[model samples]
Target: MRYLRSRVVTFCISYALWLTLSFSVDWQHLLIGLLVSLFAAFLMGDMFAEQAHKWFSPRRYLWFMIYVFVFTWECFKANLDVARRVLNPHLPINPGIVKVKTILKTESGLTFLANFITLTPGTLSVDVNREEGVLYIHWIDVKTQDVEEASRIIVSKFERILKEVLE
Candidate 1:
Protein backbone atom coordinates (compact mmCIF):
# COMPACT_ATOMS: atom_id res chain seq x y z
CA MET A 1 0.00 0.00 0.00
CA ARG A 2 2.73 2.42 0.98
CA TYR A 3 4.80 1.49 -2.06
CA LEU A 4 1.90 2.18 -4.42
CA ARG A 5 1.25 5.55 -2.84
CA SER A 6 4.92 6.54 -3.10
CA ARG A 7 5.00 5.57 -6.77
CA VAL A 8 1.87 7.59 -7.43
CA VAL A 9 3.35 10.65 -5.74
CA THR A 10 6.60 10.21 -7.62
CA PHE A 11 4.77 9.83 -10.92
CA CYS A 12 2.71 12.92 -10.31
CA ILE A 13 5.73 15.01 -9.35
CA SER A 14 7.83 13.70 -12.24
CA TYR A 15 5.05 14.29 -14.76
CA ALA A 16 4.41 17.78 -13.43
CA LEU A 17 8.09 18.64 -13.88
CA TRP A 18 8.04 17.20 -17.37
CA LEU A 19 4.96 19.17 -18.38
CA THR A 20 6.44 22.38 -17.03
CA LEU A 21 9.68 21.84 -18.89
CA SER A 22 8.46 20.35 -22.14
CA PHE A 23 6.36 23.35 -23.21
CA SER A 24 4.48 21.32 -25.80
CA VAL A 25 0.80 20.54 -26.27
CA ASP A 26 1.14 17.94 -28.99
CA TRP A 27 0.01 14.40 -28.21
CA GLN A 28 3.33 12.93 -29.38
CA HIS A 29 5.31 15.11 -26.98
CA LEU A 30 2.97 14.25 -24.11
CA LEU A 31 3.17 10.55 -24.84
CA ILE A 32 6.96 10.68 -24.79
CA GLY A 33 6.96 12.76 -21.63
CA LEU A 34 4.62 10.34 -19.90
CA LEU A 35 6.82 7.38 -20.75
CA VAL A 36 10.03 9.11 -19.72
CA SER A 37 8.61 10.53 -16.52
CA LEU A 38 7.13 7.20 -15.47
CA PHE A 39 10.43 5.44 -16.13
CA ALA A 40 12.33 7.99 -14.07
CA ALA A 41 9.80 7.86 -11.25
CA PHE A 42 9.93 4.08 -11.12
CA LEU A 43 13.72 4.12 -11.05
CA MET A 44 14.05 6.86 -8.39
CA GLY A 45 10.98 6.54 -6.16
CA ASP A 46 13.03 5.78 -3.06
CA MET A 47 14.78 9.15 -3.15
CA PHE A 48 11.60 11.07 -2.33
CA ALA A 49 9.46 8.35 -0.79
CA GLU A 50 7.95 9.59 2.44
CA GLN A 51 5.04 8.97 4.76
CA ALA A 52 2.20 9.76 2.41
CA HIS A 53 -0.07 10.91 5.20
CA LYS A 54 2.27 13.77 6.13
CA TRP A 55 2.62 15.34 2.70
CA PHE A 56 -0.89 14.79 1.42
CA SER A 57 -2.31 17.17 3.98
CA PRO A 58 -3.88 20.36 2.65
CA ARG A 59 -2.00 22.53 5.16
CA ARG A 60 1.34 21.25 3.93
CA TYR A 61 0.42 21.99 0.33
CA LEU A 62 -0.63 25.50 1.24
CA TRP A 63 2.66 26.15 2.98
CA PHE A 64 4.60 24.73 0.05
CA MET A 65 2.88 27.15 -2.34
CA ILE A 66 3.59 30.03 0.04
CA TYR A 67 7.25 28.99 0.25
CA VAL A 68 7.50 28.99 -3.54
CA PHE A 69 6.14 32.51 -3.77
CA VAL A 70 8.42 33.77 -1.01
CA PHE A 71 11.46 32.10 -2.55
CA THR A 72 10.75 33.58 -5.98
CA TRP A 73 10.39 37.10 -4.58
CA GLU A 74 13.59 36.76 -2.59
CA CYS A 75 15.45 35.46 -5.64
CA PHE A 76 14.32 38.43 -7.70
CA LYS A 77 15.33 40.91 -5.00
CA ALA A 78 18.71 39.27 -4.52
CA ASN A 79 19.41 39.43 -8.24
CA LEU A 80 18.69 43.16 -8.34
CA ASP A 81 20.87 43.77 -5.28
CA VAL A 82 23.75 41.82 -6.79
CA ALA A 83 23.39 43.70 -10.07
CA ARG A 84 23.58 47.03 -8.30
CA ARG A 85 26.74 46.06 -6.45
CA VAL A 86 28.36 44.70 -9.61
CA LEU A 87 27.55 47.84 -11.66
CA ASN A 88 28.91 50.17 -9.00
CA PRO A 89 32.30 51.74 -9.80
CA HIS A 90 33.79 50.89 -6.38
CA LEU A 91 32.48 47.31 -6.56
CA PRO A 92 31.34 47.43 -2.93
CA ILE A 93 31.24 43.95 -1.46
CA ASN A 94 32.03 42.43 1.92
CA PRO A 95 32.62 38.88 0.68
CA GLY A 96 32.73 36.64 3.77
CA ILE A 97 31.46 33.34 5.08
CA VAL A 98 28.83 33.59 7.80
CA LYS A 99 27.22 30.88 9.87
CA VAL A 100 23.47 30.53 10.27
CA LYS A 101 21.43 28.01 12.22
CA THR A 102 18.31 26.16 11.07
CA ILE A 103 15.70 24.43 13.18
CA LEU A 104 14.61 22.20 10.30
CA LYS A 105 14.78 18.67 11.77
CA THR A 106 14.49 16.60 8.62
CA GLU A 107 17.42 15.94 6.28
CA SER A 108 15.27 16.81 3.24
CA GLY A 109 14.33 20.15 4.75
CA LEU A 110 17.92 20.98 5.62
CA THR A 111 19.11 19.99 2.17
CA PHE A 112 16.42 22.14 0.56
CA LEU A 113 17.42 25.10 2.71
CA ALA A 114 21.06 24.70 1.77
CA ASN A 115 20.23 24.48 -1.92
CA PHE A 116 17.93 27.47 -1.62
CA ILE A 117 20.76 29.58 -0.25
CA THR A 118 23.12 28.44 -2.98
CA LEU A 119 20.57 29.15 -5.72
CA THR A 120 19.85 32.70 -4.60
CA PRO A 121 22.18 35.40 -5.91
CA GLY A 122 24.91 36.97 -3.75
CA THR A 123 25.03 33.89 -1.49
CA LEU A 124 26.50 30.43 -1.74
CA SER A 125 26.21 27.64 0.78
CA VAL A 126 29.86 26.73 1.40
CA ASP A 127 29.26 23.99 4.00
CA VAL A 128 26.69 22.53 6.33
CA ASN A 129 27.33 21.21 9.86
CA ARG A 130 24.37 18.90 10.26
CA GLU A 131 25.09 18.06 13.86
CA GLU A 132 25.13 21.68 14.86
CA GLY A 133 22.41 22.69 12.36
CA VAL A 134 24.73 25.39 11.05
CA LEU A 135 25.25 26.49 7.45
CA TYR A 136 28.32 28.42 6.36
CA ILE A 137 27.25 30.72 3.52
CA HIS A 138 29.48 32.97 1.45
CA TRP A 139 27.73 36.30 1.14
CA ILE A 140 28.61 39.14 -1.24
CA ASP A 141 27.58 41.60 1.45
CA VAL A 142 28.14 40.31 4.95
CA LYS A 143 26.19 42.78 7.03
CA THR A 144 26.94 41.22 10.42
CA GLN A 145 29.11 38.60 12.09
CA ASP A 146 26.59 37.63 14.79
CA VAL A 147 25.13 34.18 14.32
CA GLU A 148 21.55 35.06 15.28
CA GLU A 149 21.43 38.17 13.15
CA ALA A 150 22.92 36.38 10.19
CA SER A 151 20.40 33.59 10.50
CA ARG A 152 17.59 36.08 10.72
CA ILE A 153 18.74 37.86 7.60
CA ILE A 154 19.58 34.77 5.54
CA VAL A 155 17.08 32.15 6.65
CA SER A 156 14.24 34.40 7.76
CA LYS A 157 10.69 33.15 7.09
CA PHE A 158 11.93 30.48 4.71
CA GLU A 159 12.81 28.22 7.63
CA ARG A 160 9.46 28.82 9.26
CA ILE A 161 7.54 28.01 6.08
CA LEU A 162 9.65 24.93 5.35
CA LYS A 163 9.30 23.60 8.86
CA GLU A 164 5.57 24.00 8.63
CA VAL A 165 5.41 22.27 5.29
CA LEU A 166 7.89 19.43 5.88
CA GLU A 167 7.39 18.73 9.53
Candidate 2:
Protein backbone atom coordinates (compact mmCIF):
# COMPACT_ATOMS: atom_id res chain seq x y z
CA MET A 1 0.00 0.00 0.00
CA ARG A 2 2.81 2.35 0.86
CA TYR A 3 4.65 1.57 -2.37
CA LEU A 4 1.50 2.17 -4.40
CA ARG A 5 0.95 5.49 -2.67
CA SER A 6 4.52 6.52 -3.38
CA ARG A 7 4.12 5.71 -7.05
CA VAL A 8 0.91 7.72 -7.28
CA VAL A 9 2.50 10.68 -5.55
CA THR A 10 5.51 10.50 -7.82
CA PHE A 11 3.33 10.29 -10.90
CA CYS A 12 1.29 13.32 -9.92
CA ILE A 13 4.38 15.42 -9.21
CA SER A 14 6.09 14.34 -12.40
CA TYR A 15 3.03 15.04 -14.51
CA ALA A 16 2.63 18.48 -12.95
CA LEU A 17 6.28 19.27 -13.64
CA TRP A 18 5.90 18.06 -17.21
CA LEU A 19 2.88 20.22 -17.83
CA THR A 20 4.48 23.23 -16.20
CA LEU A 21 7.68 22.94 -18.19
CA SER A 22 5.99 22.11 -21.45
CA PHE A 23 3.20 24.69 -21.08
CA SER A 24 1.12 22.90 -23.63
CA VAL A 25 -2.46 21.64 -23.73
CA ASP A 26 -2.20 19.98 -27.12
CA TRP A 27 -3.11 16.30 -27.26
CA GLN A 28 0.24 15.07 -28.51
CA HIS A 29 2.16 16.94 -25.82
CA LEU A 30 -0.23 15.72 -23.17
CA LEU A 31 0.19 12.13 -24.32
CA ILE A 32 4.00 12.39 -24.39
CA GLY A 33 4.10 14.07 -20.99
CA LEU A 34 1.90 11.36 -19.52
CA LEU A 35 4.17 8.65 -20.91
CA VAL A 36 7.36 10.32 -19.67
CA SER A 37 5.87 11.05 -16.26
CA LEU A 38 4.76 7.45 -15.92
CA PHE A 39 8.24 6.21 -16.81
CA ALA A 40 9.87 8.54 -14.27
CA ALA A 41 7.38 7.65 -11.52
CA PHE A 42 7.90 3.93 -12.12
CA LEU A 43 11.67 4.27 -11.94
CA MET A 44 11.96 6.61 -8.95
CA GLY A 45 8.81 6.04 -6.92
CA ASP A 46 10.46 3.89 -4.23
CA MET A 47 12.98 6.63 -3.46
CA PHE A 48 10.31 8.75 -1.81
CA ALA A 49 9.71 8.71 1.90
CA GLU A 50 7.20 6.24 3.39
CA GLN A 51 5.15 9.24 4.50
CA ALA A 52 4.87 10.47 0.93
CA HIS A 53 1.32 11.63 1.59
CA LYS A 54 2.73 14.59 3.49
CA TRP A 55 3.73 16.03 0.13
CA PHE A 56 0.10 16.42 -0.82
CA SER A 57 -0.80 18.27 2.34
CA PRO A 58 -2.12 21.79 1.79
CA ARG A 59 -0.18 23.09 4.78
CA ARG A 60 3.13 21.99 3.34
CA TYR A 61 2.25 23.48 -0.04
CA LEU A 62 1.37 26.79 1.63
CA TRP A 63 4.68 26.78 3.45
CA PHE A 64 6.51 26.06 0.20
CA MET A 65 4.80 29.03 -1.45
CA ILE A 66 5.79 31.25 1.44
CA TYR A 67 9.36 29.99 1.19
CA VAL A 68 9.50 30.89 -2.51
CA PHE A 69 8.51 34.47 -1.78
CA VAL A 70 11.01 34.75 1.05
CA PHE A 71 13.77 33.33 -1.10
CA THR A 72 12.95 35.70 -3.96
CA TRP A 73 12.93 38.72 -1.69
CA GLU A 74 16.25 37.72 -0.17
CA CYS A 75 17.73 37.25 -3.63
CA PHE A 76 16.53 40.70 -4.67
CA LYS A 77 18.03 42.30 -1.58
CA ALA A 78 21.34 40.47 -2.08
CA ASN A 79 21.45 41.65 -5.71
CA LEU A 80 21.06 45.25 -4.57
CA ASP A 81 23.77 44.86 -1.97
CA VAL A 82 26.14 43.27 -4.43
CA ALA A 83 25.42 46.00 -6.97
CA ARG A 84 26.06 48.66 -4.40
CA ARG A 85 29.41 47.17 -3.52
CA VAL A 86 30.30 46.92 -7.19
CA LEU A 87 29.39 50.54 -7.87
CA ASN A 88 31.33 51.83 -4.87
CA PRO A 89 34.87 50.50 -4.91
CA HIS A 90 35.52 51.36 -1.26
CA LEU A 91 32.34 49.70 0.01
CA PRO A 92 34.48 47.24 2.03
CA ILE A 93 33.98 43.66 0.90
CA ASN A 94 35.78 41.29 3.23
CA PRO A 95 35.56 38.13 1.17
CA GLY A 96 36.15 34.91 3.10
CA ILE A 97 34.73 31.51 3.87
CA VAL A 98 32.78 31.01 7.10
CA LYS A 99 31.27 27.97 8.76
CA VAL A 100 27.77 27.98 10.21
CA LYS A 101 25.68 25.33 11.85
CA THR A 102 22.24 24.27 10.59
CA ILE A 103 19.45 22.71 12.61
CA LEU A 104 17.95 21.05 9.53
CA LYS A 105 18.28 17.29 10.07
CA THR A 106 17.02 16.00 6.73
CA GLU A 107 19.30 15.89 3.70
CA SER A 108 16.66 17.57 1.54
CA GLY A 109 16.30 20.43 4.00
CA LEU A 110 20.04 21.01 4.12
CA THR A 111 20.34 20.81 0.34
CA PHE A 112 17.50 23.33 -0.08
CA LEU A 113 19.15 25.70 2.38
CA ALA A 114 22.48 25.40 0.55
CA ASN A 115 20.81 26.05 -2.79
CA PHE A 116 18.92 29.08 -1.45
CA ILE A 117 22.16 30.56 -0.12
CA THR A 118 24.03 29.83 -3.34
CA LEU A 119 21.31 31.34 -5.50
CA THR A 120 21.47 34.60 -3.57
CA PRO A 121 24.04 37.09 -4.91
CA GLY A 122 26.66 37.79 -2.23
CA THR A 123 26.89 34.29 -0.71
CA LEU A 124 27.93 30.91 -2.06
CA SER A 125 27.56 27.51 -0.46
CA VAL A 126 30.98 25.90 -0.65
CA ASP A 127 30.38 22.64 1.18
CA VAL A 128 28.03 20.84 3.54
CA ASN A 129 29.06 18.66 6.53
CA ARG A 130 25.95 16.64 7.21
CA GLU A 131 27.38 14.72 10.16
CA GLU A 132 28.31 17.93 11.98
CA GLY A 133 25.26 19.82 10.66
CA VAL A 134 27.51 22.59 9.36
CA LEU A 135 27.71 24.50 6.09
CA TYR A 136 30.70 26.30 4.65
CA ILE A 137 29.80 29.48 2.88
CA HIS A 138 31.74 32.16 1.03
CA TRP A 139 30.43 35.56 2.02
CA ILE A 140 31.28 38.73 0.13
CA ASP A 141 31.23 40.76 3.30
CA VAL A 142 32.34 39.10 6.50
CA LYS A 143 30.20 40.73 9.18
CA THR A 144 31.51 38.63 12.09
CA GLN A 145 33.65 35.55 12.62
CA ASP A 146 31.40 34.14 15.34
CA VAL A 147 29.70 30.96 14.23
CA GLU A 148 26.48 31.67 16.10
CA GLU A 149 26.21 35.20 14.72
CA ALA A 150 27.05 34.10 11.22
CA SER A 151 24.49 31.36 11.37
CA ARG A 152 21.90 33.82 12.55
CA ILE A 153 22.74 36.29 9.79
CA ILE A 154 23.04 33.84 6.93
CA VAL A 155 20.79 30.95 7.87
CA SER A 156 18.11 31.73 10.45
CA LYS A 157 15.48 33.18 8.15
CA PHE A 158 15.58 30.35 5.67
CA GLU A 159 16.10 27.68 8.30
CA ARG A 160 12.98 28.53 10.22
CA ILE A 161 10.72 28.34 7.20
CA LEU A 162 12.54 25.34 5.75
CA LYS A 163 12.03 23.44 8.96
CA GLU A 164 8.31 23.80 8.41
CA VAL A 165 8.32 23.26 4.65
CA LEU A 166 10.95 20.59 4.08
CA GLU A 167 12.04 19.00 7.35
Candidate 3:
Protein backbone atom coordinates (compact mmCIF):
# COMPACT_ATOMS: atom_id res chain seq x y z
CA MET A 1 0.00 0.00 0.00
CA ARG A 2 2.79 2.39 0.97
CA TYR A 3 4.71 1.59 -2.19
CA LEU A 4 1.64 2.24 -4.30
CA ARG A 5 1.04 5.52 -2.54
CA SER A 6 4.60 6.61 -3.14
CA ARG A 7 4.41 5.64 -6.80
CA VAL A 8 1.21 7.64 -7.18
CA VAL A 9 2.74 10.64 -5.46
CA THR A 10 5.86 10.50 -7.63
CA PHE A 11 3.78 10.16 -10.78
CA CYS A 12 1.71 13.16 -9.80
CA ILE A 13 4.71 15.33 -9.06
CA SER A 14 6.63 14.31 -12.16
CA TYR A 15 3.63 14.63 -14.46
CA ALA A 16 2.83 18.07 -13.04
CA LEU A 17 6.40 19.21 -13.71
CA TRP A 18 6.34 17.71 -17.17
CA LEU A 19 3.10 19.43 -18.05
CA THR A 20 4.42 22.75 -16.81
CA LEU A 21 7.50 22.42 -18.99
CA SER A 22 5.91 20.92 -22.06
CA PHE A 23 4.16 23.02 -24.72
CA SER A 24 2.55 20.31 -26.82
CA VAL A 25 0.55 17.19 -25.96
CA ASP A 26 0.69 14.94 -29.02
CA TRP A 27 0.84 11.13 -28.72
CA GLN A 28 4.60 11.07 -29.21
CA HIS A 29 5.11 13.78 -26.62
CA LEU A 30 2.69 12.14 -24.18
CA LEU A 31 4.45 8.77 -24.55
CA ILE A 32 7.85 10.25 -23.84
CA GLY A 33 6.54 12.22 -20.89
CA LEU A 34 4.93 9.13 -19.39
CA LEU A 35 8.06 7.08 -19.78
CA VAL A 36 10.32 9.73 -18.25
CA SER A 37 7.98 10.55 -15.39
CA LEU A 38 7.57 6.87 -14.52
CA PHE A 39 11.32 6.38 -14.56
CA ALA A 40 11.76 9.34 -12.19
CA ALA A 41 9.01 8.06 -9.93
CA PHE A 42 10.77 4.71 -9.66
CA LEU A 43 14.05 6.35 -8.71
CA MET A 44 12.74 8.93 -6.21
CA GLY A 45 10.10 6.90 -4.46
CA ASP A 46 11.07 7.97 -0.94
CA MET A 47 10.96 11.74 -1.62
CA PHE A 48 7.20 11.92 -1.85
CA ALA A 49 6.32 8.89 0.27
CA GLU A 50 6.13 10.70 3.59
CA GLN A 51 5.52 14.45 3.07
CA ALA A 52 3.38 14.16 -0.05
CA HIS A 53 0.26 13.80 2.07
CA LYS A 54 0.85 17.19 3.67
CA TRP A 55 0.94 18.94 0.30
CA PHE A 56 -1.73 17.01 -1.60
CA SER A 57 -4.48 19.61 -1.42
CA PRO A 58 -5.99 22.46 -3.41
CA ARG A 59 -5.25 24.93 -0.63
CA ARG A 60 -1.54 24.09 -0.84
CA TYR A 61 -1.54 24.74 -4.61
CA LEU A 62 -3.35 28.02 -4.04
CA TRP A 63 -0.61 29.05 -1.61
CA PHE A 64 1.98 28.06 -4.19
CA MET A 65 0.28 30.22 -6.81
CA ILE A 66 0.31 33.15 -4.45
CA TYR A 67 3.99 32.57 -3.76
CA VAL A 68 4.77 32.56 -7.47
CA PHE A 69 3.04 35.88 -8.04
CA VAL A 70 4.69 37.47 -5.05
CA PHE A 71 8.10 36.18 -6.12
CA THR A 72 7.60 37.43 -9.69
CA TRP A 73 6.54 40.89 -8.53
CA GLU A 74 9.55 41.07 -6.24
CA CYS A 75 11.82 40.05 -9.08
CA PHE A 76 10.52 42.81 -11.33
CA LYS A 77 10.77 45.40 -8.60
CA ALA A 78 14.30 44.30 -7.75
CA ASN A 79 15.35 44.52 -11.38
CA LEU A 80 14.17 48.12 -11.64
CA ASP A 81 15.88 49.03 -8.40
CA VAL A 82 19.15 47.53 -9.57
CA ALA A 83 18.87 49.25 -12.94
CA ARG A 84 18.14 52.61 -11.32
CA ARG A 85 21.15 52.30 -9.08
CA VAL A 86 23.36 51.36 -11.98
CA LEU A 87 22.16 54.21 -14.19
CA ASN A 88 22.62 56.82 -11.48
CA PRO A 89 25.99 58.50 -10.90
CA HIS A 90 26.14 57.51 -7.23
CA LEU A 91 26.88 53.81 -6.93
CA PRO A 92 24.96 52.89 -3.80
CA ILE A 93 25.70 49.34 -2.91
CA ASN A 94 26.54 47.68 0.37
CA PRO A 95 27.88 44.40 -0.94
CA GLY A 96 28.26 42.10 2.07
CA ILE A 97 26.98 38.76 3.21
CA VAL A 98 24.55 38.77 6.10
CA LYS A 99 23.44 35.69 8.00
CA VAL A 100 19.72 35.05 8.04
CA LYS A 101 18.03 31.99 9.46
CA THR A 102 15.52 29.89 7.52
CA ILE A 103 12.72 27.86 9.04
CA LEU A 104 12.33 25.53 6.05
CA LYS A 105 13.26 22.03 7.24
CA THR A 106 13.49 20.25 3.91
CA GLU A 107 16.43 20.31 1.53
CA SER A 108 14.27 20.99 -1.52
CA GLY A 109 12.58 23.93 0.18
CA LEU A 110 15.92 25.43 1.17
CA THR A 111 17.28 24.99 -2.34
CA PHE A 112 14.23 26.68 -3.88
CA LEU A 113 14.51 29.55 -1.41
CA ALA A 114 18.20 29.87 -2.21
CA ASN A 115 17.44 30.03 -5.92
CA PHE A 116 14.71 32.59 -5.32
CA ILE A 117 17.10 34.76 -3.33
CA THR A 118 19.72 34.50 -6.03
CA LEU A 119 17.21 35.38 -8.70
CA THR A 120 16.07 38.46 -6.83
CA PRO A 121 17.60 41.83 -7.74
CA GLY A 122 20.11 42.86 -5.13
CA THR A 123 20.52 39.67 -3.15
CA LEU A 124 22.66 36.62 -3.85
CA SER A 125 22.60 33.51 -1.69
CA VAL A 126 26.26 32.76 -0.94
CA ASP A 127 26.01 29.72 1.27
CA VAL A 128 23.59 27.75 3.40
CA ASN A 129 24.33 26.23 6.79
CA ARG A 130 21.62 23.59 6.79
CA GLU A 131 22.35 22.36 10.28
CA GLU A 132 22.14 25.91 11.63
CA GLY A 133 19.12 26.92 9.56
CA VAL A 134 21.25 29.82 8.39
CA LEU A 135 21.83 31.36 4.94
CA TYR A 136 24.47 33.85 4.06
CA ILE A 137 23.18 36.31 1.50
CA HIS A 138 25.05 39.13 -0.20
CA TRP A 139 22.70 42.05 -0.20
CA ILE A 140 23.13 45.29 -2.12
CA ASP A 141 21.21 47.27 0.45
CA VAL A 142 21.34 45.52 3.83
CA LYS A 143 19.46 47.66 6.30
CA THR A 144 20.38 45.78 9.46
CA GLN A 145 23.13 43.70 10.99
CA ASP A 146 20.62 41.89 13.22
CA VAL A 147 20.04 38.36 12.01
CA GLU A 148 16.36 38.30 12.95
CA GLU A 149 15.68 41.55 11.14
CA ALA A 150 17.57 40.33 8.10
CA SER A 151 15.55 37.14 8.04
CA ARG A 152 12.35 39.10 8.34
CA ILE A 153 13.33 41.22 5.36
CA ILE A 154 14.78 38.59 3.04
CA VAL A 155 13.65 35.06 3.96
CA SER A 156 10.27 35.42 5.72
CA LYS A 157 8.52 36.40 2.49
CA PHE A 158 8.94 32.90 1.07
CA GLU A 159 9.51 30.68 4.11
CA ARG A 160 5.89 30.28 5.19
CA ILE A 161 4.65 29.90 1.63
CA LEU A 162 7.43 27.43 0.79
CA LYS A 163 6.69 25.46 3.97
CA GLU A 164 3.09 25.09 2.87
CA VAL A 165 4.10 24.11 -0.63
CA LEU A 166 7.12 21.84 -0.02
CA GLU A 167 7.08 20.81 3.64
Q: Which candidate is the best by TM-score?
A: 2
- Per-residue lDDT for 134 in model 3? 94
Best by lDDT: 2
Q: Higher TM-score: candidate 1 or 3? A: 3
* Runs of candidate 1 exceeding 4 Å displacement: 18-38, 119-121
Candidate 3 regions exceeding 4 Å error are 1-3, 13-29, 47-50
TM-score of 2: 0.88
- TM-score order, best first, reads 2, 3, 1
lDDT of 2 by residue, 43-134 (tens): 88888654576777888889999999988998898888888998996887889999999999887898899999997768899999999999
TM-score per candidate, in order? 0.80, 0.88, 0.81
Query: What lDDT does each candidate get?
Result: 0.85, 0.88, 0.86
> Which scores higher on lDDT, 2 or 3?
2
Model 2, which residues run further than 4 Å from truth? 48-51
lDDT per residue for candidate 3 within 25-142, as digits (tens), equals 7878788889999998887877655566655688878988998998899899888988999998988887788999999978888898999998787899999989989999999887
* lDDT value, candidate 1, whole model: 0.85
User: Could you tell me how far off, in angstroms, the CA of residue 118 lies in candidate 3 after the best superposition?
Assistant: 2.0
Across 1-167, the per-residue lDDT of candidate 1 in tens digits comes to 34667777888888889888988889998999899888877877766756555757899899889989988988898889888998999999989999999898778788889888876768899999889999999998889999999999888768888888887
C-alpha RMSD of each candidate structure in angstroms: 2.7, 2.1, 2.7
Q: What's the true lDDT of residue 64 in model 2?
A: 94
